[model samples]
Target: MNKRVGNQTVRLESKPRIISTATIVGPKEGEGPLRDYFDTILQDDLNGEDSYEKAEKSLLYSVITAAIKKANLKEQDINYLFSGDLLNQIISSNYAARDVDIPFIGLYGACSTMAESLGLASMIVDGGFANHAVASTSSHFSSAERQFRAPLEMGSQRPPCAQWTVTGSGAAVVGTEGNFPYVTYVTNGKVKDYGIKDANNMGAAMAPAAVDTIKQHFMDTGRTPDDYDLIATGDLGKIGRKITAELIKDYGYNMDNIYIDCGEEIYDAEKQGVNAGGSGCGCSAVVACGYIYKNLLSGNIKKALLISTGALMSPTASYQGESIPGIAHAVAIEFGGDKNE
Candidate 1:
């Protein structure tokens, strides 16, 4: 049993399952087409919290507990909690983890935390080191604006290329056994920076990383787009998705029939006027843990590849004239695959 599958991808032999999931979104996301997929939709971003950052922590903690409850497990029963967020030092996940007694592994993968955490959890569970692990992440628009650009109170004018950061959180329970979607393979993406400097145009910055990881996943797994029902990117929005599609197509992956991005699907791009679309750690989190998870549970989608994309840059790096770097982590989940695989 060596589970390693080539350089970047790892095949899981133990079959870790998604026992349960929970998602909470703000009013803007709640108004989207997939509203019913979420477990809770807040009327406002703060929900009486003093600040958007605190609201973000509240969202993460709430979702973690909700997912645990849905799985019929106690907090102490969770062996480990994998979590992350966009705020400085990942304060949202740090503070949220404090309220729970489970061991925590805080991550900072920008928007890719959801998939990153899930892949890691699956690895540990598949290795027989843990029976149950929880993976979760969150993001807030107002808080992101304050940290990345200007506060919303400044009434900043955003360019058409700018995307709206999602204000939401998503949590999921991964365990050794369940009649849920099985985590079969994990592809770790390399950091790919194309000298992008603009903080607003994250899609352009992260598209190359997405393409690189996706192309490698196919190469390593010996599978193509036709092998899976869908390939979903965590965020990437419209601009990034197009860039990824065009680039990966150069490698012979015609994904037009099976590809979609969570960012583009979360908002009504035409009616909402969100410009490019949505981008945030929560953008893909809520969609994957909610919509996609539910769809998998219902057997509507037999196999899916969730590649959560991230822009690995900060306000400090941007101010210092450093170019933005991007990364993407892909996790392959399927239903009723070969029993021994």
Candidate 2:
């Protein structure tokens, strides 16, 4: 009954299975290296919606539906829905869940919402609280830009360090019974700030938090980087990824063998115009729900550690010159290791 594994880690005895997953991405992301993994690719970022917010909501709804459909469940069959977005008051998730009959739990962890929601969903099912639950998140370049930086129409020149916001959404269906990829452990993170003020440089602000949570995960699990076929940070992009890789080395861990950032993996830095890489809540969501999930099913990766990072800063806080704080949550998932009994 006691699932606490360490100061920050929880070992889920039930090992809730990831029943199904779905990913939808914008044209830019669809053009990236992991294009084949995504379920739907929009020719236009708006997805026929007049506003980016509406498009993001649509993306969230579509992916959540797709995941559930893949699991052969209807909305009435789902016990709980955990979702969020970067929009103000998380309107994308709130409005999308507006029509669903399932109990809704809105989350807010910036770009880390995907992992935050997924971790909680897995726990709920693992604790016998639900038979089936859903976790999802979404983000859009236009919506995020207008809120966090400048309006897209203004065409403001962004600095080289700025990463592109991923216009996409991802969802996963978690169930108590299945032989699919299982959620074994979750390591929650602490908020960290290093006096970084520029919103454009989120990777730098968030790198320390990624490093801290990952280091804590290793310490708690007694597992090295080699234990996982892949160790992915949510959206540290190039700068944050480099910083995390270097800082983690100081903790006596060598992650170079299998470590990668979802941001960098989402886009081709050489061919894409995206300055550093991709960011936003959708970055890790789509990557994990699409590429990683498929690989797990294919037996290409028996184990994976997904660490989603977030820069906890509001426009008002940033305007007041408050330094950005970062947070990360790591979920340990494995296939062919355990089955629901």
Candidate 3:
């Protein structure tokens, strides 16, 4: 049938359910305001590994395995695994997949990977192509820094607008039937670059992409900000959040009441000493899976729209003086809904 609702949105008739979720964070994130919401917290950034990169892989492995276990499903029971990370070749997710023994689909949407994987998994399960699927994403501050910037010891001067890359991983299992939160729709974003070239200022670069996707989501669904209990966007710290608000207002949608940026809410920015809060694949992943998922389960929220935005720029692109292109994917999740009702 015509699952396509609008130009970029898909209205899933099957409503794939998020059966279970697991989130793991490093020491910094564990010390943040949302510390209590996470499923697992590693006291050490290295997580008992010899290298930070390996530790990131460990985080991904822990979350994926824990999500499968929480759902009472074995690795073999999952028909597909969609995962990604902020690493060259996505080595973190690649190695994690090696340990899980599931058919894997590696994706790269920069930091928007969590929503990207979730959207794909929802479609697969809703289309009868799979009964169960796992969607996961991870990011590490040390690994990202080494990949995209300088080494930790280099003591690079971070600008006020620069965001801290979150050290964490989150995974969720999407199945045909469950009593948990259900994914009802998805909106895949388009790459948009607004001539911004500062790698540190990711929020500014990605804000427009987020606004475009959110506007498309509302237009396609014929919904407004009031329709959902919350509208959360991936990173977008303070600067990006402001820009998004202004742009959305220009589009005739007032988001002042319901909007929350995961990066801004994840930490006590002043106390944490993080210049511009957090930004990474794990930033939105952990917040959505840990904090938002629990709130939905407790009936605190009936409907939520999570827009995970990514800066699709590689070290090579940045080095070449190319402007950062941004993308965002939106997923609508609802809890405790009957199929007919």
Q: Give candidate 3 regions above 4 Å deviation.
A: 337-341
Write down the TM-score of every candidate: 0.98, 0.98, 0.98
For 128-159, candidate 1 gives per-residue lDDT tens digits of: 88899999999999999899889788998888
Model 2, 282-338: lDDT tens per residue?
999999999999999999888999999999978899888899999999999899753
Off by over 4 Å in 2: 338-341
For every candidate structure, what is the RMSD over all alpha carbons to the true structure, in angstroms? Answer: 1.5, 2.0, 1.6
Candidate 1, residue 250: lDDT: 96
Q: State the lDDT of candidate 3 residue by residue for 157-199, as single tens digits.
A: 9999999999999999999986889998999999999988888
Global lDDT of each model?
Answer: 0.92, 0.93, 0.93
